[model samples]
Target chain A: MANQDFVGIPSQVDTRALNRGASDFQRLRRGLLFNYLILGAGAILMIVPFIWMISTSFKPQAETVSFPPRLFPINPTISNYIDVFDRANMGRLYWNTTFISVIKTVFNIYTSALLGYIFGKFVFRGRDVIFYILLSTWIIPFEVYLIPLYLMTVQVGLANTYTALIVPEIFTIYAMFMFRQFMYTIPTELIDAARIDGAGEWYIFHRIIIPLSKAALFTLIAFYFMWNWNDFLWPLVVIADQDKYVITVGLATFVGEYWSQYGVIMAGASLAIIPILALFIAVQRFIIEGVVLTGLKG
Target chain B: MIQTIAQKFTGRRSTLRAAEHRFIVIALVPTIIFYAIVKFYPIFFSFFISMHEWSLFGNVSPYVGFDNYALLAKDSLFYKVMWNTMYRTFAGTFLGAFCSLIVALILNPIKRGSILLRLIYFLPVMTSVIASATIWKWMLQTRFGLLNQLLSYVGIQPVAWLQSTTWAMPSIIVMGIWGGIGFTVIIYLAGLKGIPKDYYEAAEIDGASSIQLALKITLPLLKPVVSFVLITGVIGGFSGGFQAIYMMTGGGPLDSTRVLALHIYDYAFQRMFMGQASSMSFVLFAIVLILTLVQFKLQRVDWEL
Candidate 1:
């Protein structure tokens, strides 16, 4: 960092610039070091729960309640995981959840795109009214919908069925709203251009609009997938059969039943968490950027 | 930007041809019907259910107009639950906002491995609340919890975090912050991204310190996003915490951790007091609706002050 080896007489301005450059360099380094220490500590705090959960999952039952806790197991084992599968029907939970989440997400995204396209692109009577009505429903909390929706499910003979799980949530508003906003970015001229080419409406949607909407599409897909995967409340209220349980409900019940069995329960938690986390981490770049993108538009 | 485009759509409605009109009708008609049945009708039916003595098994459900709401007004436990809900909502939202702002401020400056840092922070946000609460419950465990073990290094004794009435709500609130901070941080970061770097460079040329730069340059500009996070966070907080509380404490330790969501679920499902639960949900609905209106009004006010 030394600049004392200058061959000729340095101009006053050059010395000031050099001094400022060195100070700026030091300041930048200081800022980076501060960031590392503070953010590093914060990041560790954030993941400690996950690390502990994973660590506990590998521990023996006896070690779980031991006086002095160990971050890593002295004798790591997979017994807790086996116990989760054996006792909690973790595989069935995974299958049921996957089936439900996939269907629900598909329905949610597709319907929202269609409706959003209609509202955002089309010029029709009462479009704004209809769109705003649907948008307004976004404010109503799911808690308000829980009881009556459950009762309605039973009344319609859809109770305890996968239909109950997916039907009530088929037309989600938030994603639809997002799609509608995203639709604005698609020029009206494109639709008009397609129309002039004698392209069918659905053709334009499938070939053009859908393809053009990859940005919002991927982001909303990632988010809704995660939300559907982690959804606990509605599923918990509607599905009562033990075999029909989703992962969140299964985990809740598992934790309740195995309240004191820290190791196996943590294993169950791990099983419930890992697939979604893995999926998220894989597509995380899209998600993080998508959040920033939608955060503004939303 | 959104306003202008939306206004353009209003002022200049495209002349619809038969096929385009059909497409619009076909897509929207069923969706409107779906919304009416699934979303709108439920509110009315829930109101209807609220005015009666309803249950899962009983057949002789008698109508009792306004009684459920009246009952809630008088019930001490309902009051406690309201207090708990407000306590959790305000504490969780505000604290989470503050922490996220700080994290985002510190985080926005770093160029290297920022994504990794964000990913680590967002770990819990991706994890199911039930799973997060399970891990939190174990960590807050009195005998073998990680928290107590860590606290012991400073000569602090083991505290029954979920068992003590005093500590239980705070514990849940802290957990709420943990589950939520990453999300709000992303919002703040996005807002931070909107700010042009020229303001900072100009201010720095005038010898503004980092703290002053943050206060004078960053915060004032970031007000809209800050309030957005706080408003949305508070709104969500009212109806949230069910999965977490259900897993962690089950509204126990003297119902200290009980919020409106948990209480509503408990009454309807466990106790079969569907009428009362519906009424409580109405209360929640009103609170959320009011907050939303307030949000709208706040947004309308130019964020100058």
Candidate 2:
């Protein structure tokens, strides 16, 4: 049960005004004003923590815990931001997270698209059997496998390594399912036409199919990258080395270490949050639509 | 290439068919192998682990044969944890769903600044749960927290939010709603989009008030989406909250905030009780499976995976 998420405003308001008297129009207008008031207050509630985060990030230690809860700092400082980088190895954390996320997202998307194309576009014996079998794994909670997966990582001697981070998750079920869904949109004529034109099967998938899948690609990339970047439990379990820590894992430990250092902690939180939020906001239209496309409700 | 062509002719397999077969085998073989090793095998292995008194550091894991599951049955703390998990799941899901539905219903008819308003709502959704939890913990701090400070101005006493057992779970549930309402609002918005405008217009022409129209036309039509949200929300709630709970309370003040997911992580990782944790995870799996089955029955669920 899905539809285009952003339909134009429901037209009943206008219709009611046209059908009824001026009193109705006046009432509707007042209702609209009331809606705005409620929405405005809710929006403020929605963003206050973020504003407070940014505000507290800039404040000095004294101001962070000050009486009356200062919304604006009496004295702002960059020292906390500096401390996050210096003590928490925030740069290294960023690099580690970005690198791992990029690798994982690429693996996740590319493999998913390929398999999705195969399962969707190509008909072969046992294809549905294989796909549904794989898809069934989607419902199994990650916790069900967490203990065994960790032990397997240790058994394979991949523990405390980034490969431990990426290898086990190179193929993801959800994205693959989405790509499979996206595959139905791509016409088979394109594949057969390319086949008639003497393009190799792999070449068709790469040059024709993948290029055609940019719509699904961008959305999956944005989401998978964000999810991977923010992944914590696995990295927390596997990567014991601080240098190898992803940003989420790094921030978790950093918060625990500096729990009392309010400004510095907020600075760390701000840095961790700002990158992904900016990335999403920039390409948000696609994601919002992609949510409709994928039925990926968070 | 010549040999392949000859074999294709001899074997009655067309060249394109051969290529397609090759491509599929190339794609599927690895997928099958990967799922078997990583997905299917680990589930079985985890189940196997649950049947024993297992620890990674310990060499000898004497097979306990449902002893771990039995331990959960007898343990008072496990019962407490179960209660907490249900409390969090139902409270968070229902409250979050209700709030988002209201927002979506209101936000649906707006003709101005809708995107900006939606984006503002979605800010917390995009932020990492851990990061959101971090900010939330600060705001909910006992003395210096913003929530307490705000309460002071209203002449209410400063209450311990995350530190008090009574307040901790509610505080967490509220935070969960705040963090998730934007997302659920989007879902409800999409759901609202599905209901045709004709019904509303018809109701309005029949002299039905706005509230009546919502109660009659909109609510009835949106039943499936409401169920979808509730069902998925409950399912996710079973396995969710590890990150937020981990960061904020660490399942503390009195284990009041300890949900199953966090308990599993704590037992498996922190306490080195892997076997017991695995059993708890199976319990979670059973719960999720049952709810998912209900979702499937309630909704068409086609292409929703």
Candidate 3:
């Protein structure tokens, strides 16, 4: 029954009842065939752009601009990729992005989980008031705070630095709230048992709570990494030096600088997408779970 | 005698409670401080900056109370940007949510390859906006584009998708829907899973067609999910137009696709009009807050039904 819930299909009993007669069975099969045809076609439409992206990345410059553009390159080459790496400082861009993404993801997950553990497990003075204040911050979009944050960064003399990129992104109210929701499901008895064993609060948290909340932790890590990796606007606003640019910022500026270099632009884009696509495939299930938890709860 | 005993026990318990409270404070200190400095402070500062004649390189700017707001009221570009923002928000939200719901309903009945299909659909959401926008820009190119090539087979004229003022916003909307529908479909699928099968069975016994079962049972039950998608979609649509616009069109072809977020970006960063940009940000914030609250209030009424 639980499996049925997850798969979201009719139960065997319902199916058997519906498939009583030969004509009904045939009609059911026909309906399913129709559904598959529509779904398959839609899937093709969804997948084609990505396929086109990869194909374009491999195409020579001439083929990229050829009239009535071909879906597949007539004579594919690695020259575009070579040009992107050689001139675009692709390596530096990757390093800057990876360093920021890793540090930000680690700090964000740890802080959010710590706050969530406290909010979920402890009864402290002004807890509700504090939590609600944190919740209210989620309503204030980044655009509202962007200029002041830039000013604040400048005042602190951190503008155009990695500190500017990483610090402001380390704490998110949504991640904290998500961890709190996950922590609520953990049984209180486990904590009580640890307390009875005379474990310190920090010890209990590190040894017991952290290990038990692995799923939520992984979810947060994957999401935060992707977000920081792909973030453009703040990076664009704050970082002026090309050497410090993240992948998205680098790619965007590259396009602006060389708008007519279609093959090179496609190559850079392909390289930018590969890491995220790999991450998605590796943790695809958890990504879906995270989206369901966040989206449905909204 | 019993009162004294109870008092002794309570006194010891209160000490433990105090210890736990201290622990909570210790655990939460970093998060709270970070939020205070980074999140809370900036919100108040944004409001403060909106009231001043601020610029990029100044220690202080003279107060110009509501002058920026007044300027915005008379600014024609601000109104045009707001209209663009509204157009994208409504059109994107409606199309994305409606298409996702339909896709989810169709996928819910299929047992084979459903997971793979869902993953394929979600590829765009996983992709970086820069890359996706780049691909879209290429595909939407006037003469040498793939979309135009495909349309030619059906005898349709080649359209300058991202080049023309009239077509640019719709092009952005198409990309927005394509990128957004996957996540919404996943949410709707979850909602569909939560619906009890007994309702469908009962409806089928009563000779309810698939369409009737969907309209009467599925749609009503999915109200919460629909409302959730709509509110988030609106918020994302309003605030999240910057990346796509920046990468694909840069508010392009005569600023026809320049949304309010991009407008603020231009004023604050490009033109260095910090005060005016701050004012615009507040206006955008106000609109979003009202829309969100109205959605929640309406959803509450819907739930009561």
Number of the predicted model whose DockQ against the real structure is largest? 2
- Candidate 2, residue A237: the lDDT equals 91
| lDDT by residue (tens digit), candidate 3, A15-121 | 22223355445545648778778888989989888888888889888888786667778898999999999888999999999998899888888888888888888
In candidate 1, what are the lDDT values of residues B1-305, reduced to their tens digit? 57545644563335337678778778877887888899899999999999999999868789999999999989999999999998999999899999999999998876656778888888888888889999999999998999998899889989999999999999999998998787777777767877887898899889998999999999999999888888877888888788888888999899999999999999999999999899999999999999989988888743112
- Model 2 / residue B43 / CA error / Å: 0.9
**Model 2 per-residue lDDT at A254:** 95
TM-score of chain A of each: 0.87, 0.86, 0.86
Candidate 2: residue A8 Cα off by (Å)? 17
Give the TM-score (vs. native) of candidate 1: 0.91
Quote each prediction's TM-score: 0.91, 0.91, 0.90
lDDT of 3: 0.80
lDDT of 2: 0.84
The DockQ-based order of candidates, best leading, equals 2, 3, 1
True contacts kept of 3: 0.67
Could you give me the TM-score of model 2 versus the true structure?
A: 0.91
Q: Which stretches of candidate 2 lie over 4 Å from their true place?
A: A1-30, A286-298, B1-13
**lDDT (Cα, tens digit) per residue for candidate 3, span B191-210:** 78778879988988899998
Error of 2 at A46 (Å): 0.7
- In angstroms, the error of model 2 at B259 is 0.9
